[model samples]
Target: MRDRIDEEITFRKLEVLLAFMETGNLSKAAEALNVSTVSVHRALHSLEQGVRCALFRHEGRNLKSTEAAQMLADVAQEVLTTMSDGIRATREAAGYSSDRLKIGSLYSLTIRAVPGIVIDIKVRRPTLQVELALGSNAELLDKLKRGAIDAALMALPDADPEIESIPLFEDDIFFAAPAGSPYANQEAVDLCDCRDETFVSLGEGFVTYRGFLEAFRVAGFTPNVTMRVGDIFSLMNLVSGGVGYTLLPGRVRGVFGDQVQFIPLKPQFLMRQTIGVSFLRARERDPNLLALMAVCRLRTRSVI
Candidate 1:
């Protein structure tokens, strides 16, 4: 019996039942649903036949819902509501919503790069909804490849063949320390000078960590890392408290303000972080991605 009902019942019939329940008259129900009176009568008749139950009673020219009909109506309302929510969630997940734009970026860029691009995008597309996700370079790149994010602001060059990147600018890696530290006053600091200094470093998997390794290799020594922090701000805070020195991009100065100083690396030990926007090569023609790419180019052109 349950199988029979499942095979017979349909959303159109439930909608007709709901309309009939509200209007209590076949003609009025049909008018509300934009169907003919005969169509409404036939739909209600089919619904009762499908469930093998009496769902309505006639009083003169009007039809009234029975207890069984009211119960089914309640269940139908719930089903409709759940289906509506599910459809909306699916659309958001698929990135099919016209006004939505999902963006991924590194924590360090949020201090300045992300904000500038967001403001420019909002000005150009006032109704566009922006969603920002911050993560390490590897995580952001992964999200882009999987279509979880529309675009990413990260270091280049991503090895994924599907990822097409546009270079925004090259940011020089600098040695960061407390403002009163001895290295803060130097014109340029050699990485070897800090070889013995207990260092504060970003956790492995961060782009900065890779650059840190390269600088150490050039200096001919490994750092005696004292802490592995997850975010640049926290790493800077530790350095400010006289914890240890760290390596970071020049842009970090905006966040640390006067608390920290960034010194250039000596010519022989100089290393740069190439910052850029990345997206799936297939989404190159997507309007939202294009808009974001334009904003990034406009904002970084002057600074780079």
Candidate 2:
């Protein structure tokens, strides 16, 4: 017989504690749990009163775990994992398996690389239906954390303990100019040449934008930004129309379809961004994930 749940140990309390542990901030934890922040606060308060001990110490919006709280969190994770596997097992025993796989990626990648990989996977696993979600890097990561997506193909995110990332491809950054652009025929051009050019760029808060800024710093010049827009296709379109030149990833040629010409910078400026597969560490062991990883590994190796 299974042991009874503790009178005070409600699933709600465990969920509150686990969410806090997963995300360092209360608001984000509430977001992950799909509950109001106030509800989470009340649940923790009630839990503390019932347990007769302080489980969390507040630091601004963050809840730092006490030793006891950490202990409970470890067990809570075990409980959650057990519950998840139990459900999966029950489904499998019923002769039911998920028919569709959810995949995600950034806009730039969805146009070419991700589709190619998806098509290849479909040919190999005809029983699987692939669903694609496209978004910015941050949005996709949030979806993965909340179990909204199985995995994504994207640039490496900021350091995240919960995310398990693997390298797939290394793309170099290049300078893209319109045909007959001033620096077009030049064997190589100085970074400063772009200093005065009206720069069309991706909006702030993109990994690519951050990398682009760093590349400029390395090239020893600050670009004159005349416009900022979202999506690489639009940026490429603007560049093609002679609005301004922008830094282009080596793979941009594959997506932009010969609409733009790539010029090698004099010093050959290249910022290597790995386009890899990423998923929550917690789901890393799912059988579907394992199969997907095998497909990605096989495809990525062939390309490299």
Output the number of the TM-score-best candidate.
1
In candidate 1, which residue ranges exceed 4 Å CA deviation? 1-97
TM-score per candidate: 0.70, 0.65
The backbone clash count of each candidate, in order, is 0, 0
State the lDDT of candidate 2 residue by residue for 119-208, as single tens digits: 777777789888899877777888887777889888878778989988888887778888778777877667865666787788875667
| Residue 63 miss distance in model 1 (angstroms) | 22
Candidate 2 clash pair list: none
lDDT: worst 10-residue window of model 1: 1-10
Q: lDDT of each structure?
A: 0.85, 0.78
